[model samples]
Target: MTVVNGYEQSDAEKKLNILNLPSLADEAKKIIPTGGYGYIVGGSEDEWTLAENTKAFNHAQIVHKALSNIDSPDLSTNFLGIDLKTPIMMAPTAAQGLAHSQGEKDTARGVAAVGGLMAQSTYSSTSIADTAAAGNGAPQLFQLYMSKDWDFNKSLLDEAKKAGVKGIILTVDATVDGYREEDIINNFQFPIPMPNLEKYSAGDGKGKGIGEIYASAAQKISEDDVRRIAEYTDLPVIVKGVQSPEDALRAIGAGAAAIYVSNHGGRQLNGGPASFDVLPAIAKAVNKRVPIIFDSGVRRGSHAFKALAAGADLVAFGRPVIYGLALGGAEGVQSVFEQIDHELEIIMQLAGTKTIADVKHAPLTHFNYAD
Candidate 1:
């Protein structure tokens, strides 16, 4: 039987027959409608950063050692006190319903099945309570976009706390929405009846929708404010979307439990450096004070390994998870996880490593970039 990305051909249907990352993305585009397809794949403006996010991974090469008696590698690790079977979490990407009918619920289920964690976006189609219920008490975090109305954000925080989310990931990069040319061209919008924000709406159609409400209500999230928010909640505060060491240091100074180094999957700030490109410096600045979680352009397990060797405590993915959801809902998401996890296991065995801790701080070199 032909094996593709660790899944056998006989098991193709069970594995979504997704083959590899490129095929998975193509299949997703084929399954989703045109507007949603564009929104899912297109990056901001020139999309240089989107391209770079993946390219930066290509520039770094993972060096593998072959002569060790490692038959099985342990992938388990602890992130902010949550025991994860693998050091992978689903990055908080909004509007999952655009990909599949079940949306965040399906993604959460898939994460739970794999014993991984997920950070739910504030713009999710489902309400926090419903999503928590659907997640069935799986370890989860709530990603926050501070609103112009302090009352609204505070109330949302209260809801997340009550819903039993383990942590709060405060996204600070997207003060304004990125110039998503595809979103404009396709006229893409989040589905109406956003369960999470329904209670906050004026109730008379005074605004366009929740998206508009979010746009108008979003206030600039400051580093100082990050500290205040951490104080407001007993749950851990993780600051996501940080791309610089200085900002990372500031987040750490502000009592952040972790620093999530990301370029918003290259969906925001088209010309910005790739998340991988900026990771080393941020890792250097962080210097183990706080755990560093990374995302952006992690399509394969090799990318995850490279990020780990370079200094990421945990690696996350957004687009691939959405692609999986688009193809076969929760099962597809599980297949994607299985593929990556399988590949990671193989890499660890071949590299003479026996665990997630063994993968970190390995010597990595760049292959094709001219300095």
Candidate 2:
């Protein structure tokens, strides 16, 4: 059995004949607690958007070109001025400790090992400084859920800057968490401490629901807040959770360095359009002004290819990475990325795209789906 990034190749091959996402998730399910698995996999009420996030990819078809003399498609690209070995990055998912003991620290190490990027969430179990240390100088971004308390926000940003994060991701979608039925069914509560928020929490939050804790964040996020955070940190700010062109324009107008198109993995709004469904319009609206980071339901290399063709500069995913962590810790996380990048390389060659830039111009056919 071959060992790549600590994952046994034979084990992966024996189980699924490939390092597949669904198979990895099924393996993780056997170990992770029910509440934790639900938190990682389940989306908000009805889950219409959750299903659509991946299903929406079926509507777009990539036209494969023939006779383009490309043997190895390059996956290297840049995001927010940072050069990445692959355009596939890890999206910010909170409470990774629920999946593994080391939490964000282990995640950071795995992403760094693969030359990919990671955005640590404000609700992460590991502290910003510790996670950064674990990365050992990997290019990292801090995802901020602006607190209603201005002092707390400032303190959080201060900690992020001191930790040497490359940028700040201002997540604007989840001011209040959407109704997640799995959480209710399990009567779930955070089983671990969020080191980043521990100092600021007013109470221990015993008996209170996770949604209540999340709702305590500032609900009135505005463009002014965007400008303030950017000015304070003097770091590039990527406005996340944008679902429309208007909001994209507004974010750029507010001095955002980049636009992150996401629907919070369908965890914030139940009936919202899939993140992939809105990328083309938002990309058109941005008009090459800044980089665009996209996430939601990206399960395959072809999915990443489609997003790039639709105007996403970088594609990110969360659930699969967590599943990998649950199964093999940091090594498992690195293996998941390796498999996705390998799949992407094959897809790129099939599509006759030699570089990430070429993927932007790859011809695509769109089919309208009846709602």
**CA lDDT, every model vs. true structure:** 0.80, 0.86
What is candidate 2's local distance difference test score? 0.86
Error (Å) of candidate 2 at residue 1 is 25
Residue pairs that clash (backbone atoms under 3 angstroms), model 2: none
How many backbone clashes are present in model 2?
0
State every prediction's TM-score relative to the real structure: 0.91, 0.93
User: Which stretches in model 1 have alpha-carbon errors above 4 Å?
Assistant: 1-15, 201-214, 369-371
Top lDDT: which candidate number?
A: 2
lDDT of 1 at 21: 65
193-253 per-residue lDDT for model 2 (tens digits): 6777767753333344678677668989999999999999999999999999999999999
